[model samples]
Target: MLQTYAMVVNRNKNRTKLSTSSVEKNINVVNTVKNPSNENINKMEQSKKPAKRIIGTKIMEHVKLQPDKIIMKKKVFCLSNVKKCHRDDVVEFLQSSGINVITCFPVIKRTDENDPKAINNDEHSTMFRVCVEKKDEGKMKDPEVMLQHIIVREWKFNEKKLDFKNG
Candidate 1:
């Protein structure tokens, strides 16, 4: 009776090992089917490349069709009375105040000889040309209101005229 019991225990252990091995093989086959190999993944990525290229080309074509619309979206403004500040200092000050200055230069205004306030020397002032986006153009129209710290003598929006020559 003792021998028969020992033989039964050994048989159960062997059966358990065989079943576990078969289960591991089945799991490997399922994983392979669900997750593709590297080569298959590469092929799928290559197939998606052309679709992305087509989308990029469509965007470029749309931009080319309406070039004037893009030009109208941005406005240029000339800011005067920069207080004879250096070019770098003016740019840094404007940048600190959240103003995007495109170009800056010192402008010498000719003084009128007849005017009582006119000086003998040329009046030097720094001028800044800034490109403002359409969304912010309205707010930036009044430099005195927008830039409270800076002394603004004059502010004006630059007008751009399109000239087309007919052959």
Candidate 2:
């Protein structure tokens, strides 16, 4: 019955890190359980007895359990569909998801080849593609789950725009 723990560092003493050798010295000793009835159990139990006293001096300093006080930079997934999302609805969704940026790609318009930048030019055309992705925060399964939620919530066709903003 041993719990493998890291060496506790005295923050007030100005220690930035635990001694690396401490971890190296007892690699196989931590978290190992020996059956009390086993012949070698006595030896294992005896070996760990001295380490038990230092358990309080050792602290868990792993990343998964550590607290993150700093603001995390969120990565927004740029989603594009055949239609565009309503600005107000998009804003609301972003607010709910804590998304700082909603990157939107422009819808490609079909036009004649007179303009070099026309859609007829394969190189210049823009087509919308929605990329299902995870929320900036929280425990969403994956992009596929996000896509399913979007489909279920029907955010793709929530509202229609009457006029296009001229750039």
lDDT of 2 by residue, 139-165 (tens): 222354244334222124436554536
Candidate 1, 67: how far from true, in Å? 9.9
- Which runs in model 1 stand beyond 4 Å of their true positions? 1-72, 111-124, 142-167
Judge candidate 2 at residue 7 and give its lDDT.
94
Per residue, candidate 1 scores C-alpha lDDT tens digits across 73-157 of 5566666655665566766766676656655554434454465443323334455555656555655666554555554433464
Q: What TM-score, computed on C-alpha atoms, does each candidate reach?
A: 0.33, 0.23
The parts of candidate 2 lying over 4 Å away from their true place are: 1-76, 102-167
Among these predictions, the greatest TM-score belongs to: 1
What do the candidate models score in CA lDDT, each in turn?
0.56, 0.42
Please give the range of 10 consecutive residues that has the lowest summed lDDT in model 2. 124-133
Q: What is candidate 1's CA lDDT for residue 151?
A: 44
